[model samples]
Target: MSAYLQAKVVRSRGLCVLSSIGKSVLNRDLWLVTVGDATVPYYPDPESPSTAYPKPKFAYIGGMHGDEIGNVQLLLQFLEEVCTAPREARLQALVDSTVLYIVPCMNPDGYVQLTRLNANYKDLNRNAYSSAFPYARPTTRDATIRNGYGTPLHPEAAWFLTAGGAAMEPETVAVTSWLAAVRPTVSADLHGGALVASYALDACDSKGSINDCPSVEAPLPNLLANAYSMNHKGMRVQLDDTYGDGDFVNGTTEGASWYTALGTLQDWAHHVQHLHMITLEVHSDKQPFGRQLAVLYSLNRDSLLRLAEMAHLGLKARVVDAVSRAPLLAHVELLEPKGMWPPEVEADGLIWKVAVPNMRYSGTLTPVDPGNPDARYPPISFNFTLAASWDEVVSGTGLQGLSAVYTMRARQARRK
Candidate 1:
């Protein structure tokens, strides 16, 4: 099989602007294809006018596992369609406000051999961390894996043993570094072989999942839950009929058969960078490649458009101060632990009244020390509060103090 993509992958002519984000382990050009205009700010800037380009961003990753060919095709199709579609449409309007960053394939070396492991036989997903540099040398069993190419010593094990956690492959290092820089509000990593949306949170082996993390105070996750349902309308039908898990569902019940790998892209994406994330498994039963690819493309089209729209709509807010009885710059965070979606934070540019969506969130406004605005230590107290949405419209005060405890609504959604 040729290392290059043999499929007829043709994206829309004007939709995607492809650029190299970094180089892979073997020095192949790693592309960071963006599907929106570049004039927008990456994060929300309140100082700018209402016409200010909104900084809401959503990231989509595909083919972190090189062998997941379906994801590669799906993402490519999405890039073309979303970029070329009319901006006045709901999907294009969302894309206009939201910035999308996609890494179509993370493991170029592994894809070359049609193998799960990368060039040095490193499993890209398993090997993710700031440390763990210098690709790990495969052990004796690695040679055995290479030999048993045609036959499966159990397909699950074949895929499982391909990589491990904590070791950072070059691609992962580049991707993670970029994630830190972009700090997107919402992100998703595309995977295959399972036809469901998996919101795997911090706990490895998918145990002790929080229905919602209190830190995400807003109704952000709830909005996403509804959005996910809306995007996949009429297709969530399964024998069990249980489509969404609300938040985290323990691994034991949901066929938790895989090994627990730490420092995963999703974990770091949420834990470290504070972005809401989902591991979208597209299709099941290891169906026909062409059929699976089509399913992936179908799912990607709706999901991507929905996410971009949500980011654009969700980022709308105003900041104010508590003591001055005036508009102030404060930090607002929206977190969802169950879905592993990162927190969304906005500072300043709030006016007398702000209309927040029904979604739950831990909202706060902090007094910025003119001396050191970024000072994270010993944060100042005194923020604003409005009991109800109507109250928020009239109140002009900043936050009175720091939150007694950071609260979010991810767990709340799971409970209901």
Candidate 2:
């Protein structure tokens, strides 16, 4: 573990360190540091006063590739700045309004060895669950015996493909389990070797070629990518002549459009977890320290805070009982204009529906059985129709700071 990371863990007010499933090959502790509203429970306890509401959750993950030192360093720097600068009003407001989970280094073993893969010689980026390589087997163990000369097979790949008995890699299980538990509204996995914000659908279809599959959560990533690129000076300009048109328009690209890969974290988060996640390729170099680190942090400071605020960019509300005034664990269904899919419902009764800044959509709040034995209320089915124009929900101009918490009341279920 880096001394800097340890120091941050000590000094940061809301720091929670979670140990990865297994120690690194060198036996170093792989830590996931979460900062912000530490008291917020992962799930609402029915026995306790329900604090669950439509607050946005955001995740920032880095160091999936061991050699991507810049990715990890940038996240650490962000954490330090936010923790140390308590008087910074913007950051404090963000913390107050949203829950931020950060996994600073997902591949500590690879980082220690200065390799892209872990000690098992598997690329963690390719270890996630994806539709393209659903049944892919682990070749790392086999490759080791073949003098390390074969296709890489991550432990996660093996576990998913195996019929009945296999375990996921320690790091993979750690991050995946955490994400599934928290279920952030938006997340970004940092990377190096490129300078563009990459959006989801990182893998091709079952046929194995790149397809222009657009995500239903496209607007959120688009807004996030633009915020990062536009805020950073010179990021929008293309200095590298080798890439397309020498410049990334506002520094963003679709993942599969850039290159097809199977089992990437961003795709897994979007497809499996139903979260809006993106891969942020911060810089072209794998490692940049000291002065370079300062420059990187300075450039991305505002963008980082802005992205956190993006969670409030949509319509948010809580579903409650009509007479009892108790929170009801319910499903929010968005009936958008033709051809758009509805957003996923949260585990809590909180509903957050992402709409374009000025678009119109109809939403329905349907109360269903929460299925938890400790739940405050029993499952009842009733629909409350809702219609809203973005203009009504948004408080002001520019979608960044808009937030509304409407308390929707459901009618009692009539006996048939």
Candidate 3:
């Protein structure tokens, strides 16, 4: 890992470091490589004084399930490609506009032992706070012996469950801290066991029935999943009805509808962090080597690039006080296209609304008044119903890009 980082990442001007890992784990250094130019300033956040512009941030995580070696290798290869192939125009534009964080392996102990559990025998994927069945006291044999149970007793389990009062594992702590600090706009968690891209709502009711609950941030995930599957040679074409009568169309599933995966990383990222995240189950084989590696990379290279480019997709703008012109942490909501909701305003008073390409949306923004010491704005919220027709939002060029600074004004007082 160090050799690869020095040779490819460091030399290529990408930032690479051992973000965090377990002390007792064999390979304790979990590598975090970031590729992008922050100076470009794609979109600035007003609330965060540290950064002038909060560039669209995207995260690609792999090897959470340690035995899924292919997951890790794919990301490593992607990172190297991004670093070494700087001359690629499309890739360069993406790096300039967005910040990419790649975590090759999240569970080194599991990778070393070729097991799904970490050194503490905890399934890191099922240990997050968003997990429906978080690690508690043991009841079943799988929980106690195989470490399949969701119990916070394990140090590793505790770490990932930091949001839920679990002990912080060094590895989990590193990722949580980084995410909190960076606050990525989108993320993809890579895993294995199937060849499909799955989206959030991984867990269901207590009865364990599939949730099938649609996600508000569905457009971005659907766009990403389609990109990944369509780019792959055979992924889009379903060969067999393995997942109940052609369940996955175009290589994407709604997660819980396919299977109940409580406490998954993607769910935690979406619900808790309010980030558009998906789980990419890349290969049928957990470990692909030699020719298979090249073939896999070829299948998804363009798709990866396209996914990164999606950072600029949808609607983005800054919501500020109309009088003071100062950034305001506003509440932005989408009333139209019922299932999708807008992400909360960033520290810089910026809000991003992810929507389908051709669809119209009705959005509302309520900015907090700066002069008001109580932090309360007049009840006059700004409501905008844009794109009454597909042509309005999608021009001849397609998906008309919207980037502007919206100066919100408080309701004017009526004169007597």
Per lDDT, what order, best first? 2, 3, 1
Model 3 TM-score, all chains together: 0.76
The model with the greatest lDDT is 2
lDDT (Cα atoms) of all candidates against the true structure: 0.47, 0.63, 0.62
* Better-scoring candidate (TM-score), 1 or 2: 2
Instruction: Give the alpha carbon lDDT tens digit for every residue of 243-313 in model 2.
Output: 33323556776666666555678877877777777788887888888899888888777666666666665
Q: Per-residue CA lDDT of candidate 1, range 1-416, in tens? A: 11222221123343466666677789876676776665654333434333243345677787777676676677766665665545436555455556778777777676666666677777766555333221223333432343346664233233434555325678888888887877666677766565545443423322222233332323433344334434553324323323334322221112121223334576566456556665665544322376666666675566556544444433344332232333334443323222323223344342111113433433333433333354332223222332334222112122111011111111111222
Shift of residue 293 alpha carbon in model 1, Å: 3.6
Q: Which stretches of candidate 2 lie over 4 Å from their true place?
A: 14-27, 38-54, 131-168, 206-208, 239-247, 337-341, 368-400, 413-416
Q: Which candidate should be chosen as best, given TM-score against the real structure?
A: 2
Task: Please identify model 1 stretches exceeding 4 Å from their true place.
Answer: 1-15, 41-53, 85-88, 129-162, 202-226, 233-235, 239-261, 285-292, 313-315, 318-364, 367-416
For candidate 1, what is the lDDT? Answer: 0.47
lDDT, residue 27, candidate 2:
67
The better candidate by lDDT, 1 or 3, is 3
